[model samples]
Target: MTTLPVRPVTDVPARPQPAAPRREHRLRSLDGLRLVAALMVAVYHYAGRGGEVARAWGTSPAEQFPTLHSYAAYGCLGVQVFFVISGFVICMSGWGRSLTSFFASRASRLLPAYWAAVVLVTAVFALPVVAYEAVSPSDALLNLTMLQMPLGVDRVLGVCWTLWAEVRFYALFALCVVLPGVNRRRVILFCAGWTLAAALTRSVHEPLLDLVLMPEYAPFFIGGVGLHLLHRDRRDGYGWGIVAVSFLIGQHYAVRDLWNAADPHAFAHRTSGGIVLVVAFAFVAVGAIALGLLNGVNWRWLTTAGALTYPFYLVHEHLGWPAIQLLHRTWGLPSYATLPLTVAAMLILARLVHGWVEKPLTPRLRGVLNKAR
Candidate 1:
């Protein structure tokens, strides 16, 4: 048997499969960041009222308050940060999931709480004590559907305008993800093209389409998506560097033209300023990802606060206004005192609502949704 001397079977150790890149789940830092953004928005609105009071009182004190006014300016930027975060987080959470499941999850998560807030706000507006003029049934229905923005109808829940924008963003993203032949590359290109077109059109003061329909804010979302893609793939460092530079440039321009402007409205003169702010926001989104801040250290308290933020955001504006009015009428608290007090009250109430209402209700609602499905 010319069987070649059977080579001693060499036992080759199977190469250990590379440990699946540690799949990170909880991102405590992002929760903390969300808390910071939410607080900024709350403080902004509170301080904004103070500015109005100062103006009405014809006192230089309001303008000189420095801290309050500074917060107000910075607070406006919070919304931009929110948009970026929304794009990044939502996309990351839902990527690769089926569109149906994604939409169902989103509907379950968002609609119950959102509808509750809307009804509560509307009911308050209907009450004799707080009675503002009732919205027409048509307007109310439109708002409920969250289609008011696309239709160019007036917003029923004033603070909810951003929610409409967010809804649209989600819808577009779902379409991109679910449609046949739509891959990550195509989605990226589509988003980039859409954003560039929107920015270019807006810069020229041409309305190619209504803000709601055209996705004028797509760039911020795309920037977020881009960051996610870059980070997930372990691409070259240049992308991160570019994102950082873009952020700094955007922030510099915002501070110089918008923050430092003697007349806040003057910054609005150069419509390009808004574009710059969007760019800056995108930068922050990428930086958060690259620095791992969003997915890094977990702070339970802040995470809890972040969980309550959406409801707080919705309720605080209306609640603060009334609380301020009550204090002004009864105690005649000075603007400085009243502003901080109103903010504190709103925060307290938000925590209560989150714990007592939203937290409890969310799970039950989700269960119902799952059963229905």
Candidate 2:
């Protein structure tokens, strides 16, 4: 028998492993980009086709502001930029949080200002304000839930449709990825799965599925998720692949819907090449930020600008249209003057909402949600 030497164990305990440093979540440049996107939409709504939506200029907007309209015509594509940023921001924020936490965060962020805007717009419309279609009381109540669109109620504000889109994205992301716990693999799967579902559902006449998948806007959001992966892991080939594929699919849809033949809006008649270029630039911009190209962008003002974007976007159109109508039709301001002034006023109001509503309400709402959970 081989002699077995008895080994003596030491009394020392094992050392604790060091925790990883948390990545800083804030991207100041992206805040600036958010402001840019909000401003783009504002410009498009106010000046695109010469304020045709409001018809406040008393003449054809396309003809009244031909120079400005030429460029602002593509500003509607800012919505695509917004969806892409939402993807990146949502994934970045949702990572490592519980599903309840995610829900609370989104609700807190979206609802306070949304509620205020709904009330404000409804009240303004109820009065003899600018002659836009008045939202009914029942519709206003549904709008408060942000479920007006799916419930077959008219939107209190046309821009509310985008909020519904965002809510759907959040729902899908929460259930599929966040509920199970967010990880690189899960996010990749979510992106791929959503893309496929969106594609398949495009031809299927299922209203519910179409609403959930949002086929027209899915690529931008998916690409944002992929880009966030790259941001987190540092230069991932798989992430780049996802972004590339998303761009291709998204580009095709953008051209088809906005330019080629699918209910082509009169203002969306830009050269297909131009639309492709703008969409390409949007992807490249977000991708660059993800890859840390914008890391050194530490401008503090971008923070304030970013905070104002949501309320600015929320209140801009419905409120500003009336302002535009009054200033142009009643006060005799020129289109150029009226547009800028209206935007300035909206921005000021956004700052106020950010300060009075969002800043105060978000934390309280979040606290309530946390306790309920």
Candidate 3:
């Protein structure tokens, strides 16, 4: 056997090419988890809006099953979860796009669906049901901009308040995109400075300022941006300090709000301290995003649930209230029965809006805007 130069099996370890970085694949679970957050909000609304039947269902629904009530009451905080997710998604989405493209994308997503929902709500107002709220002509005009809050007008739909926050956040983030040297750090600085401004104006309530920065809610958004940085950079320690500070600030305000409002029905922290619920909610969102818990959770219905959330959220409150009132009052259905019926109706209507209105309108709007540009 010609002893070929015995190449040692462990020949000089070839310089390990730096391990190819792990690509951050799309987290489908986040999409699925969105329905989780939306469902929580729905449950919150169902219970909170039960009105007289709330007592019939049980004791103070917030106090009856304290655990269930607490979770449901805190469900309004689901919007915070939505906010953080929005910040992360927006950062990911608007990263390299030009300002016009980013704004066009937002308008295409937001405006048409909102206008359709407004029309649907206006039609519902035409019904004889006038117990919940009177139809205001001004609200109809103000709501068209989705800037009602900042402009000192009531939202046409109660839930559209969240849209106002989202619109301002889009404006804020768009400004960041245009600023040179804007990075996660710049965002944190803006958050801190913004929070400080809110603190300075704590005694004075300025709708425009609050609507613009809403620094009281900054932590949630800041924490969200932090999560995005962690995901994109694949680093744990990146921008965590601001996230921690932001979360703590959020908890402080959450507790204070419950204390000040002291609506026994809405007090989520009555059984559990507000801070604990806040922390748990934060963890649910952070854990979901960080661990990719919902990644590749590819069920068609799950996607449908996620898609339904927007229209359902928009249409559910004003519309479902009427459905629940009709069933509970006319049919004499109990709270337990009407609750499901109302939610079911919302789902059906949301499906119609998503299929006929949003899904169709979005492409046309995008095409029109793109062509105009």
Candidate 4:
């Protein structure tokens, strides 16, 4: 807020200056990284689901091409990256805000885009899959709340599973906001508890805890929060330690995944350490972000890419899988080419939703919500 070079000279008093606009912190590199993460997941779903379908129908070959096999196997790791990012972003968002403000921010950012994505996905997937599976309108509508899993109902779209983890993370973090004396130190302790639970999550059979803790992925969420704290106070080694513990635990999961993978060809390349590479990349990326090495990633293009991420993730597989089957059957296109083409189509659809649906509706929705208060 720079003062005026010269104040107006008058017999009467001058009016007060208006407050400066608040500076919103935007991470550009993370945005770019988001697109990368989304692409990784897309590759995983495209090739991986194809393999699953083939195996289910007993049409899949024992061997696959080098690139597709590796990507299909390891691509699932991208969701862990999303989790880390979600923790960091959620923590960053809660700073210096009241609980109400925090919830409003989260809701405004999520619900509109999510609702639109739900409709888009349902239109693409549910109506088509009814031929094979029993999908009632009640079960499909349950996904609108994003609590289908917790309610013991199946998800309308497969991708909705990860969102259930995110919703639980949000709810847990909200406790920190509303409770007294739950500052950074307590948050760090909470991360430790979550990490420990990852090791011995006895509540797996417990319905609510199963949805809330999601023990296998809790480490990623806790690690992201740890990174947020690390970024907040660089001198805090405790934050670093928590992040390290989470990474080690995540590495363990990756190793387990590699060994248990039904398809041996995903590890054929052998350079990336197979599924371990995604977690490794996440470890490095989050650390780099926390250390502020990626301050330069604040480009507008990166911001745009980041903006495209959520909608793209929500709708990609919903659109891609059916399109993949359709193209293979009707046009006789190869799976590899069909995958990229369908991915491209999904990207276009994402851009449409972002531009025409989300961007236009979000502000109006927020304005309405604000005014109603």
Candidate 5:
């Protein structure tokens, strides 16, 4: 949702006179892809899984949206798609930035809408508008810090779990690559080392290693970095190798998640082969974007659509469910009508959060952070 600034050229030729900086082209297509990924996740939560809505409506959503439910089940893979995009975007944006500036950029980009959503969701849960679980004040406070997962506290919004994973990726990236200064060699090594560490995670007993390595999600991010390398410089053999290996490792984890899904009822009917295929598609899609295959897609409206993606993802699950419950059950609206209405309302809410919360706060937060620095 927060597209990092275009990256600086890493392969500029030497000249006696100082050369002007040439920023990489902004991949607006990636922004459009982000919105698609967000929508996929949203659809998955609302229609794919029958559990949450089934409890509220006394009927299965799968049965309600018979045609859409099967396809929607695979929408959960949108997270992996996001990670791949993140790897490419983060690496691109972080290339020429300072560590302090990087932190400031990330904090500014993430926190405002996140803080607003935490409070909004907390307030929603506190009210009797829906039968959803209420988040306590303490949990709300911890969530504001965005460190609730490691703090052993519950998330204010269940979707914030991905934020934690992203945070870990940022920390690891900053420490290993950004802090040391981003370059072709260091980035390649970072991806390579990360791939190896993730591969070995299943054989290791160290909790911290597994936690930091995030073996299940590592390949997507690693593959993303590899993709960025290709984007930055097309003749990167090591980058291609990294992408290939990461996809292989990432596919294994994706299939594993399908089989060992926490909510077996939601994914029980899904096949490992389907999961593998979907994950492979995500990688391929991202790879195509990185290689500039979609350069011709410069639809200006996608910029606005992309801007709403982050907040859309944040509020869609916890908040949308209640809206669905209220509309379908309380107002006697049918699933056909309720699903689209809820999604539209959530998108509008996301736009509001983006405009009122994120746009206004990001600059101020960045200024404050920069001043502190």
Candidate 6:
């Protein structure tokens, strides 16, 4: 073989690899938003139960303060905010992962705590001292499967109705993520189309499908996912401003319904206005991403408080009515005093439950599930 001319061995430096893009830090503003939302829900429940403060506050001319009853009446809107955040974060976390692993992880994260809560509530309702109405075995089983929404059965734990909706949303989202050759644009379009169809068909008289699909709320979750994609590549301050304005507008409509001296139909129209407001809010959320406003804040205290919100949401409604009734019977306190006191107690208990129960159990359950898998 003819020897090829000897090539010189060049000392070439290896090219440096690009660093992985770091996840945007957790935004404290979102936690703050959560804290406010959870508090609003607690306050709303407390008000509905005829707590002294709620009554007094409602009667007071100060109720129109734009921040007072506005926040209180729209507390349920917090659940919508939660759906949006959940869709965003879950998609972010589970993206690029195997569908099996994702489902397993989600099940571990949610099922154990949820099951425990249901069992405890069932026990409470069944106890001789409580003498609350007992849920049927079928209903309990449905709740266990997170299928109460579609089954047309009353929820075993009333607060858990939303949880079932969340389960459905999660399942649908996972399927979209896992299926082969799925286009992201198509997934978004499908969610949007489904939501629109649900909205259009909502006037149908059948009660069963309405309860199961929860068409009224589907758009909120779908909008949230859309917002996530919009914000993924941009972080401009103007986005935050847009979110602020949308929130304000939504609050305006909510307050108008709560305090307006209009016909009930008028109130319904105003309340329905929030759907559009929330869509606007999504645009703002996208802007927030563009502005880099999503950077994580170091508010350990607020974060800690935020962590307790879920359990607080569950217990507040149950405890609030009884607490108000007891105070009314024993001390004859005014609505204002009893309301604030009851809310304070509920918040305190929520913190305790979060620290003592949910926090401790979440990690252990996750571990067990991981091992099982």
Per-candidate Cα RMSD to the true structure, in Å, reads: 5.9, 3.4, 7.9, 6.8, 8.9, 6.2
Q: Summarize candidate 2's per-residue lDDT along 16-107 as a digit string, tens digits.
A: 98554345668998998898889999988877754435476677667668787778878888999999999999999888888889999999
Candidate with more favorable, higher lDDT: 5 or 6: 5
Q: Write the per-residue lDDT of candidate 5 for residues 271-313, one digit (tens) a residue.
A: 7888888888788888888888999988898888889999999
What is the alpha-carbon RMSD of candidate 1 to the true structure? 5.9
TM-score, candidate number 1: 0.74
Which consecutive 10 residues in model 4 have the weakest lDDT in total?
A: 55-64
Q: Cα miss at 368, model 5 (Å)? A: 1.6
**lDDT tens digits, residue span 95-132, model 1:** 65555556666776676556666666666667677525
CA-lDDT, candidates in order? 0.61, 0.86, 0.69, 0.72, 0.87, 0.58
Candidate 6 per-residue lDDT over residues 1-373, each given as its tens digit: 7988775667566689855533666665566556665676676555422333333334431342334444455455566666666655565555555665666668766765566556656766676654256587678766787777666777766567677778877777776554432335545554555555555565675766665455655655555555455566444333233334334433444444344336543211225454445445544553354345755554767677667667667766655555655565456876667777878777777677667677777778766666664
Query: Candidate 3's error at 142, in angstroms?
Result: 2.6
Instruction: Tell me each candidate's TM-score.
Output: 0.74, 0.92, 0.81, 0.81, 0.92, 0.70
Candidate 4 local distance difference test against the native: 0.72
Best of the two (1, 6) by TM-score:
1
**lDDT tens per residue, model 4, 1-373:** 8977675577558689855533347878888878888998887666654544443223442243445665565677889899988888887777655566666767777877788877766665546442234346788788788778767886666788888778788888887543443367678777877777656665446755655677777878888888888888878889989888888887776566455545554433323366566787897897798789988767688877888888899888656656766666567786667667888888888888899877887777766665554
